[model samples]
Target: MVLNVAVVGAGVVGLSTAVALQQRVKNVKVTLIADRFDEGTTSWGAGGLFRPDLDSYPAEHQSSFRQWISDSWKFYNALASSEHSQDCGLTFVAGTLLQNSPKDLGYSCISELTHDFQKLDEAQIKKMNLPSTFKYAYSCTTVITHVPTYLRWLMQKFRGNGGKVECRKVSRLSQLSDDFDLVINCCGLSAVELCQDKSMYPVMGHLVRVKAPWFKKFVFSDDLYIIPHNDYVLLGGIKDAGNWSRAPDPAKRNIILSRAYAMFPALKHAPILDEWVGLRPGREKVRLEVELIKGGNKKTIPVIHNYGHGGHGISLSWGCALHATRLVQELTSGLQARL
Candidate 1:
């Protein structure tokens, strides 16, 4: 018997979950449904850096959060080493993360997961000539995904595996019960309304793409960052919690460009390619669990929530997808045993 699975949302997280379910679960039909795709989604505007802050997760789940981070690093690291790396928009890049004080550099979690993690010495700091306010610096090699390119690649891969795509908006969980045996909610920020999750909000981000091929490394200090993608460089941004405006603010754009240019003088002359704004699905803790919802006539529909990733959606995509897939398998097997 074929299990009809509906994975909502077409962003990186949703696509990743859909692909994983199709590959791991036998005799299952996976269909990806979303109201937005590609550039319309927030995942497309991200710098796609594989850096996760331990503080993002709740204190109770620190160990599980660490596992997620490590699993994500290993998954992307292996992908970057594979022959399909370029096609999948995966690449290894060396970058520096700076802070005003040594105590503020709470990246020990990331350091443990990545390679060549080291504290920057005075010589290295002086060579970079960062502003006087930045005293602490660390360098590490990390993976980055070119969002647009990577999303396109995922769409192709998912379709190639006989996954179906449907363009539709889901307002409630019960709406899917009649057609699908199970539903995976990866609606991201829209989960606020769909799931009636009061804890969920938007963390607005703005970024500017510039034609700066000569810039080869990533530089990040606080909210300001310069990431060199395969084709262009991405400079960003602001993290205004509870802000839902998708329009690019002129004031914020100026601040981003000014800060980035101050850090790297060459960007001052680089031609601006495009500007974008996205709303990250922010919550106190990422929701990745199973819920059995009863529809009309007491029909039980198993739903797996895999959203609330916020800005780390790309970084945590694979790990979260793997976990969600496992939950799905467990749910299916339990039902099979009952039969």
Candidate 2:
């Protein structure tokens, strides 16, 4: 018999889970439900670079860092090579990580695969037009994705394969009946209230998108980054932990723009297209687990939790999706049969 799966959340993580589940099995019905979709999601504002700082991952999780990163890179890199690359906002970019502090960014292992992994010299530093003094830097050929484009592309791919999307809010897990074999929660920030997960909180952030076609490289300094995509450059941002305000602060907007223009003087000539504010679904570590939600009449529904990607939603979307899909398969197939 075919399985019915409901994936809650239309963000990158949820959409990726829906696509992966459908791809993993045949004749399965996948319904993706979320209150917000496409351009409204926090994923839409992400520069979508593939760097995962060691601090981003939880220390206690059983997931292998190498496996997740390798799998995600393979998936996006394949798309980057295909003709649909641009349509999906997957492309190769030369990135520079300007070190402003003593943070241990874990890109060393993958440096060889990057565009260029070299310490900056005095001459290169002078030409970079950056204000922060750095002792070391890593320049790499990395991947950046435009989340809005990618989300639309993924939805089309899922629908083309018989999946469905509903623009509705899921206030409770029980709202989805037992008709579905499993319900995967990819609701990001909403997961905190839906699941009563007090551990989950929001990391407030903001960004400015401007016309900077002349810029082609991605720059990173601490949590702040200025990445250039096809037609626009993304200037970001602050990461305020446990903050939930969705409104952009005027002071932050000015600070971000000033810093970005300082690094790339040409941006001063470009006009700002838009400013956006979002809450990165943050937790001590990303939450990806399985639970049995007991409803009225002692009915138990299987729920696979896959939220809390923090600021790295796009960077880790595919990896977590693959992991969640595996868990769903286990719950539906073998010893873990019904909740």
Candidate 3:
């Protein structure tokens, strides 16, 4: 008998996990169950930059962070170069990150993986034509994810591989235990309710997508960023924790537009294509381990908890998914669950 596996989210992390399960696992029926999908998920509105927020992992797992990011880069980098890139919304973007004061640019894993990475000099910074407050900068070439396209591509890939999708909200883990032999919880912010994970928090992000075909390169300073896609440019945002509102705030829009206009005057005349507010699921540390929990039938069921990815969900997705796949492999070793 094949093991039934369920992944409980549709964001990048969830879809990535489901896809990895199909590609790497055996004798399993994978079903991606989520309340929302594609453009409705938070990952869709992300700037889609590949910078990994390394601190999101625990101290013990910190060493593995590099490998995770490296593996993820390899995954996206391949797609960005493939013929399906435009169809999948995968783009190789090079951009500058600036700050007013000198700070530790210690994400060596990202720097090491970038196709081109460097610190900008006075001339380089001058060429950017930024306000004088920005004194330090660096440039790097990395993959940016257009999650809407990527997620749809993943869904199609999953279905092609004989996977299924259930568009229903799982209020709790036990509810799924009856149908699935093992459940991989990639619930993201919903974990706060489903798993009673009090540590889960939401980092509200506000973004404005403008019609800027000329804005090919991205520029980021703190939470404020301008990232480009195939058709439009994304200007954002605020990173206010514990803010759960999804409606776009006019005040937040002004803050984003005003700063963007000052940084790139050309966009001042660019028509606003859209605005969005999405929550980045945040936790003190990412949780990626297995637990034997009480099931709906009172017998134990295997649960691989893989959520709490914060802003780096896309950056660390494949790495975390592969690792989660390994956990599923171990859980079903020799079909022990069948016995």
Give the TM-score of each candidate. 0.96, 0.92, 0.95
Checking candidate 1 for backbone clashes, the offending pairs are none
- List all candidate RMSDs to the true structure: 1.6, 2.3, 1.7
Candidate that scores best on TM-score: 1
Off by over 4 Å in 3: 55-60, 103-105, 334-337
Clashing pairs in 3: none
Which residue runs of candidate 2 sit more than 4 Å off their true CA positions?
A: 102-105, 109-115, 121-129, 335-339
Which candidate achieves the best lDDT against the true structure?
A: 1
Q: List model 1 lDDT by residue over 1-339, tens digit each.
A: 678899999999999999888888988899999999998888988999887877667779777677777878888889899998999999999998887767322587788878798898788889987654587888999888998888998899899999999998887888788888899999999988999989899998999999999999988878698899977999996899999899999999999999987777778999999899989999887899889988765668889999999878898888898899888888887655543
lDDT of 2 by residue, 41-88 (tens): 878777788776664565555246556666788899889989989999
lDDT tens readout by residue for model 3, 1-339: 788889999988899999999999877899999999878788877778887745446667777677778888888888899999998888988888787765443556777788688888888889877764688888888788888888889888899999999999887787777888889999888888988999999999999999989989988788589889889999996998999999999999999999998877889999999899989989877788988888768867888999888888888889989889998888787445464
Q: Please estimate how well model 2 matches the true structure, expressed as its whole-model Cα lDDT.
A: 0.80
Q: TM-score of predicted model 1?
A: 0.96
- Model 1, position 105: C-alpha lDDT score: 28
